[model samples]
Target: MTGGPTLPALPPSLRAPLGLVAVLAALVVSVIGTLYAGHSQPGRVDRWIVSPTADPVGPPWRPVALTLDFLGEPAGSVLLVGVVVAVCLLLRRPRAAVLTVAGVALAVGTTTLLKQLVGRTIHGPDNLSYPSGHTTFFTALGLALALLATDRLGLGRTAGTSLVLCVALLAGAAMGWAEVALGAHYPTDALGGWCTALAVVPATAWLVDRAADRLESAGRPEPR
Candidate 1:
């Protein structure tokens, strides 16, 4: 499994701080999500950003928003992940391919579970909308790619952290905007979803690395 390209090592300098930030941000977002549980109206932050309405954004950008929103849909996500995984395999970065799948799956799954637990709804009673799963999905993908890039390029702490965060922020914001503009989620829901991905991906990456290491160690032949 750890055959080609030496399996880019997760930078020791970048791991701890990123993990800490993710944990703290997730906690804060969760708390805010709790505050608006079972609510139908937009909170102050959500209203300030944009009102909760069907088709909050109009023409010109509407198509663009829909395109982005589709990327979070089942077929879109599968296609997106499949492309990245294929690329990783082509590059002989198996661990990276694994991370991409695991990170995204974990991030999206976390949001789904949180939606049920938080019970924050919008538009309709049965429509759960605490954390924006679309935002979480895109952010997770970006984070996985960022981590792979950082490791492959051997970036230092500052650079790696910056790269990961920048990618995550851009991805999350893009999808979040789409979700909110379409009135599919509240702005705060988007924020929570973004933070959820930020919290989940890094930890998932670390776990992937750890499991790979264990497998490699177990497969190693004893020295004579």
Candidate 2:
């Protein structure tokens, strides 16, 4: 989606900081929400969200449900990250590739830790369901892909970002819905997972940009 001619592209310096702050805020809210949900007694919202999907609604949604579930698995997560990294490298954006991989890894690790720490229970046998690992991985991957598309693919600031945001929201909603339908997580768990990704990906990108700038500066010749 192209913006109007009057729409100005944000400078990299400003964009990075703003994105980081927004993501951090999301992470904080997600963390607090998850903790509250875990500690509080199961309420109407939790029941209402999980009930419809507890048992399969029909045959039509089965395939989509299965696909989304699979995509959130470790193998699926790895594949998604690999594809994003490969795309970035193919675009000759090594920093993007590195940042994507690192960001995903950090997000996954943090989610795992939070799951154990929070110890949120769902209908499933697994007790560590506070934040859905699958959702976290996929969300992070989506964000990384969006960043690459905007920064490297020359898709323009507005169009590329808007496209990526739409894709990421769809992907995240699908994954979260599938998890709930399968009785693997509560709605809050999925929210927490998204929050984790929001926090990690932008922070990682900012760090990568800073590191790249430092390296570039170091490699420059000294003025005589």
Candidate 3:
């Protein structure tokens, strides 16, 4: 059977144990940062960062706050991920789809689990707030969409990747600012979320690529 359009493959040297190690290091650092900020006493990082924007109820900032809240909702995240996955499937990039789905799932699940384990509470709901779930979902989605654009869309890899990265960074930053400005989460929570995506997406993508390689190799007929 004919295969789908191939994505530009990163060298195995970059995608294997080295890449995995880097991703894991990022996760560890972010986890440590979140714990440090969350568990500190009064006047710690969380308080210092949150105190300034904790009261953003004024008329001027109301619209900005509302817009951010709307964008950060779970519905928005699901929609973004759904669209990306659909596009990847349409482009016959099953590996991309798998990576996207797995990255989002891993980021979201890990954030939720960490929140519960950390048990940190702040200005927002009683639910754990060590890491912002909205930030994690959006960031991961952005990264996945960026990859699809570069890999499947046939855009110049460097230019396309850079453009997408900029946009994604802006969106992620906006979400983080909104959450912090509205007192929904501490700044470190946003940081933790971003770091979580950086770690989870690459690791998930590497694993997906490896599995795909194995499946493809197995399906090939033996040489005469």
- Candidate of highest lDDT: 1
lDDT of 3 by residue, 1-224 (tens): 22373452322333444355446647664666555544533236667766653466557876887676676677766677788889878877777788778888998898888787676677544646767787777787777777666554455535654655565577568778877777677777787777677677767777777777888888889999
Candidate 3 has its poorest 10 consecutive residues by lDDT at 5-14
The global C-alpha lDDT for each of the candidates, from Candidate 1 onward, is 0.86, 0.69, 0.68
Name the candidate, 1 or 2, with the larger TM-score value: 1
Best model per TM-score: 1
* TM-scores for the candidates: 0.94, 0.80, 0.77
* Residue 162 lDDT (model 3): 61
Better of 1 and 3 by TM-score: 1
Measured by TM-score, how close is model 2 to the native structure? 0.80
User: By TM-score, how accurate is candidate 3?
Assistant: 0.77
In candidate 1 the C-alpha lDDT for residue 34 amounts to 76
